[model samples]
Target: MFKAYRFVFIAIIACFALTQCTSVPKRTQTPQERPDVQQQTLDLEDAKSSADWLEEAWQAPNDIAKNSALVQAALTLQDEKEWQKSAAILARLDKNQLTNDANRYFRLAKGRWYAHNQQWPQVYKTLEGLPEQFTQKEYKRLTLELLAFAAGERHQYWQALAWQVEAQRYSDEPSPNALWQTASQVTQSQLPAERPRDLVLAGWWRLIDNHHQAMTSPSAFSALLDNWQNSFPNHPARERVNSWVSSDSQSNEVDKSTNTIIAVLLPLSGQYEAQGLAVRDGIIAKVSETKSYELVFIDTHQLSFEEQQSKLEELKPAGVIGPLLKGSVTEWVRQTSLNTPQVFLNQIDADTSEATANSHSIFFALNPETEAEQASEFMSSASSRTKRPLVLAANTPGSQRMVERYKESWSGINEPSVSLFSQRDDMKSAVEASLGLVGSKERIRAVKIAAGKIIVDEQERSRRDISGIYLPGNLQQVRLLKPFIDVSISPFAERIPVYGTSSAHELTNQLGDNDLNGLIFSETPWLVQNGGQNVLLNQWLDARSGWELSQARLAAMGYDSVDLLQRLPIMQRMPGTHWKGLSGVLSVENQVVNRQLQWAAFKNGSITVLEEQPNAGKNNR
Candidate 1:
């Protein structure tokens, strides 16, 4: 059943895979050994603008002078925080051509440029090796600050805290609030068993541990804060402990008592009735065991504006949820007082919210962007050498939006190669073109014409630089896409990792999903499980022959929505609080719920849930 080309390619690739990559290292040279430009001092104040400096650099008489002018221009741009422009100018100047002072300054500018691009690893790589003594006081300060920021962004919490403390030598005292936020995402296991040698960092570790233990109880948390203040008297966070207590005390203001009445608003009688019903069922299922709260469903589509307003006034519920349509959500916010804490089921843009703007409500849209964002993060954090990836999406509005979101979240320097296929017949060609196999074939044809024989030494190949392939397509498209991708890859090339979005997965027979083998995709935990509520839901759906993956996902969202109403207050107060809901690991920040979904892969025509790994990005291989 295997193709002859695959067998031939496998034999060739196996040999190549065993061959280790070798690099020719270049000898390092110091600035003093390269250039003697001490006599030619450059004055940055002489230039009015970066453009003036760039023009001056272009007209300089010597390489040293030209490099000096370029450094000044880059510095000017850095001071202005124009990172992209500064990076472009820095790219033009050779480091070897500059004096020691200019070279040191160039390193700082380059570090800032990498930081601006959100390339945290590159930022550390560029700046971590720099000398202790910088050319200017502000330069040293900025370097430390950038290192701290880069470390924090990379989730190197301890390093970030250390760098921040170091930066305080030149700047104001390091921000305890910033450090607290940095530690929010870190778990207890991440904390060292042995206390950090640095007293300041140790105090921070203790504070995080105490906060995590007592977060569920305001009284316990208040007592712990007092204890933390007494124990760490000279700690930077000691002053902020009282404010945290105040914040925790304020959280108690949100009513947490049982038997509270909550109103639900959803479209139950219109075009989107099915979606509304599924979500409603999920909510109902989640709350069935709990008798503390009363649910009141308001059909937004069935009621007129006046009728809905009157109904809400009569019910006077503790909190409201729904208005699933984007337009309805916008309209509801604009028209109502929104005094009651509400959770809208959809997201609205700033332009849409300008008229109806209310900050009290939370938006919990099942956005495709969330899946795309997580996928991007997964690929960026993965150990694969693929800096350049091919992103394949269908010629559809949803797929286009997802592709755009993925691009926005991508961390690499090179933009992903995107291939949009409109027709089923064109999918193979699109994949081949994106992976540069077409060019490989063209080269093979050229070789055959010149040699006047089929050359055994030369082989058709996929681009070696492609680290991976990301297919953000629907179930059918992804099924087709995986095979095309498998065939397009060259035998001499390393096996490229393939990733997909939730749309690529469905509950189907193992044989039906054979094409999806080796494809890793993101999906809700509810669909991947075999027991508990999933089992019950499966049995019920199977009895009625009404199981649909998309509807089940909607149901999971509804279930999480109900759970979130109770957890939202706790999450808002505790920054990194996470609730394990069927939809995902739900967390909230700035009134928006974020879902960290589970990753699953097809193995031998069956789906297997990937165990979450530490910094491993899901055992992607």
Candidate 2:
């Protein structure tokens, strides 16, 4: 209903502005010799005075500047904050007669008045005209500043920043450095050592902004809050974070030892039922051999918050996984205590205070931040050996973030690395440019010869030193890049080893036999065999009747997640060490989960293990 009202309000404003007006004429100077120039000048002054008088009169509209007076006179009533009278007068204005500058000034004035009244939509509408008609720097600066303030009031920080930056760029006046210094000093002033909700909110806001800037992960932000809690133990936010951490720790212990009741809370009867079933199967298969587990399923389809709470209370499971939709998670978190450990299949909305409070209890299914960190660590280590690590990424937003993370991680290690970029349309050219073979027939001929003398010579030169290439793109995009790699090392495919992520699993399917030969990179445990001795896991895989792709990895993660529960203390102590799990080696540090990536090279149309050791290096290239 609120959404509908907002739409209706927008439509009404659109109609009022667009239908009641015609374009104003461009401003032009009136000649002194023109006919009726004297009369026109006198009338203009009279109009201006009347407008000002009406504005003043509107302060007490009942006493003066009544409806029967001139339209300009009625508009003057607005100066007294008589908005209704001002609107009526503005409706009667001859837009065609008003000079462009006057029209703009009037609109800006109206916008400021609306903003002052907290009429955000109206303010937005009125300010829209000022941009097109006003050229004065002062007016532009004022309008932008006011608009930015209005946007900030509306909690539209990004939009506010855009206008604020524009205003600052145009304003020629010197900055108020003294005022800023005074404010900074005030902010730094010591206060009574009491926890304030406002302070917590401010800290959260700063953390969120930093997260957006790619300065830290969500977990890092949570950890910061955790530290704050330690300082002010009684603070509500602090209590919440502590409770969450405690709950997760408790749940992990329960899942490991006793015949644990693991509840799957998801929209099982509705849209995501199939996915829920898949997850259920994965969990079931993982715990089939263990006598210490039980799977309890709860359908979240169309359930209200109260119903969800009741259902969860009734189940009383050791751990809960899901409530897949973000909205459901928010509702559930708001009404329930963080007693049971929870694993969120997706990120909970950061706006929900309850969700943030209970974040310690929840673990995201796919943490891009963790993935980026691990990838960087791996690349850094590989780069140390190769001397030159080349980072390549597509022009997409996701790929760009991945590349930025890689660069950041690389920067932290104080390592030298080169970044390469390829656009979807210019992949061929970008690849050639990166290889430093941009515009030469010799290079072109060398790539074309499959096993010829030229190709062999080029291959030998390339093999003298092995260079690591990091490609952050989808499997399909990576596959397109493979042709370039093949071309670059046509004669020496065996000699030049290529490295990539687990995403390369898909690309492996796309390659021809032996095309990816000598390709080596880290992947999850399920993708490789660490001595190949999981008889039960193999039996389960063979007996399962669905897709055979990466199911093994999921099964391994499930098994590992459950198995690691009992060994949490030991795991936490040596987080960098390898844990022989179904997926690969599992590692955890500071509560951040890291996988001991299994490196493999393409061999005989399958991946062959190259290295199964934990990534021991300090730098992830």
Candidate 3:
């Protein structure tokens, strides 16, 4: 649920887990521009780290101080990424033997641990027992924030906001920073739970961060503020925004080095010439001939892969961006020596890539593999008792590739039991055979054979093991498959949900409405029915004619590619940072720019927002 801010969320939890933890990674800030997180950093740095605390607890003679030391030691251990060590220390504590602060501290520490492991129910139970008020004001505020975070993970945004509001007031930190921190903690799925409140908070963050933009485009900023204030008559952050504006005109630049030219390699001629042109246009739309960045485009059309590499060196650009084909991406990764930092616009096949081991190259793509990965994450994280997902897809080369990629991504992130099946010509037999479900005609004959002795009717079992189905197929196949899946799965089981992809468009085609109901999938924001829209984006799309709209995905891939150049420096500095961009919530890990997508489902006639609004409460001004 806390997708965009994964590393941030966990680090924040670790920051306060131990009174004695010293290595907790908090956001560093100058005192003049510091957020509420500064206080935690100051306090933690003054205390001993987990190792010191653990040793002190082992040596301390007094029982009261001993328990106190133990609690601190456990939390400190957690902050240091030593989960087993923390758990071992926790096992030594006897809650009944502790009193006052020690007892409360233990519960809070455990609550943090639950959050670390995503044990949401345990997080709530452990934290709910604390007193309504605390003797230490800072601890009280921290506790409330943790509660809000836990609630968010549980898809309880309303409750999260309640806690966040209280926490914000109680916090001895700047109002704007407190507000931003709280909003960041709210899970994406639960964003719309308090729409106006979230809008105001998000607007303030954008206002503060885009100080240069606000100064340059005062009218646009003012109109944005007016809309926000008018929409929520009494938002708490509305007044805070007025103070956020600064007269300073200097821009916030993401400085890398003196190297300024960026070489872009794409198919300027050949079969993919059209796609390359679209991407080029999108990049051009975002970037101007600014003093900061110079751009050069190299045609990958007539050149061999080695020649393309030679051309890249000739330009000697600061960073390279392009080569929209997957084959180029794979070769780029396998190169033993890379001269400059180059970003590939496509993802390589997993069988060929060891991206984690690669260097000086980045891969970003609107790949179906990424969509399949997100589907697996959504099914696992969504708060259902169901743990088994029967992944069924059409038995085609592309579908099979997507399925493997899905399994790879899913297996890497979660531990849920998953089964795979494929359908070709016969949907019914395929569905039944996949689940190992019994066929009636054969069973009837078996019953007839056993008539004299005994007949085991077996009650026509439904494999209760299957919680959902993943069908990555087109509309025709999906329409044919859904009814068969419904009949083949046992009636005793919960309604088996099917997760699909953009391959299955919810819009009415030859296969008409509502047939493939309850199919969930991730698509580009603009493609989805209830996606958070941007007027600027719409206008940009309208400006282009012919096939740009039809090839929107490839175009966006180009658009976001250029935008990523500036953000990469910031992301490199802060590993977990994310920002709202054209594609989706964009974040970088291991030099690869990842687009965290929005989820939707097919209902009555069209696809609607199923979980979170990816761009809702986002900064569009």
Could you say which candidate leads in lDDT? Answer: 1
What are the per-residue Cα lDDT tens digits for candidate 2 across 1-621?
Answer: 445434533543464466346433222222222111111111122345554443343443342222223343433444344445455456655555555545665676566556545556677766864654556565676777677655654445445544555565556652333112111211111222333345433333332232222221322434554555555554323444465567544644643443377776666677766555545566676677766667777777867667766877776676676665667766666667756556555455454344545433443344344455566666555443435556667776777677777666652233434445546778766766665554444665657685565433333223223346666665666777777866764363333345566666642352222555555555665655542333654566567656443545554555555544434433333322335665555554433345556666566766667654333232334
Tens digit per residue, CA lDDT, model 1, 165-267: 6665665445666666666655554666777778887887787777556544423756777788888899877767767668656745755652277888888
The per-prediction CA RMSD against the true structure, in angstroms, equals 13.1, 19.6, 12.9
Rate residue 539 of model 1 by lDDT: 65
lDDT of 3 by residue, 530-616 (tens): 342445445656666555343666666777776566554444322235656656777766566778876777666555676653321
By TM-score, is 1 or 3 better? 1
Which order, best to worst by lDDT? 1, 3, 2
Question: Could you tell me the lDDT of residue 151 within candidate 1?
Answer: 75
TM-scores of the models, in the order given: 0.70, 0.48, 0.55
Clashing pairs in 3: 462-490
Query: What residue runs in model 1 are displaced by over 4 Å at the alpha carbon?
Result: 1-147, 162-207, 214-259, 351-360, 383-387, 453-459, 509-512, 530-534, 543-545, 612-621
Q: Tell me the whole-model lDDT of each prediction, alpha carbons only.
A: 0.70, 0.51, 0.61
Q: Model 1 Cα displacement at 399 (Å)?
A: 1.8
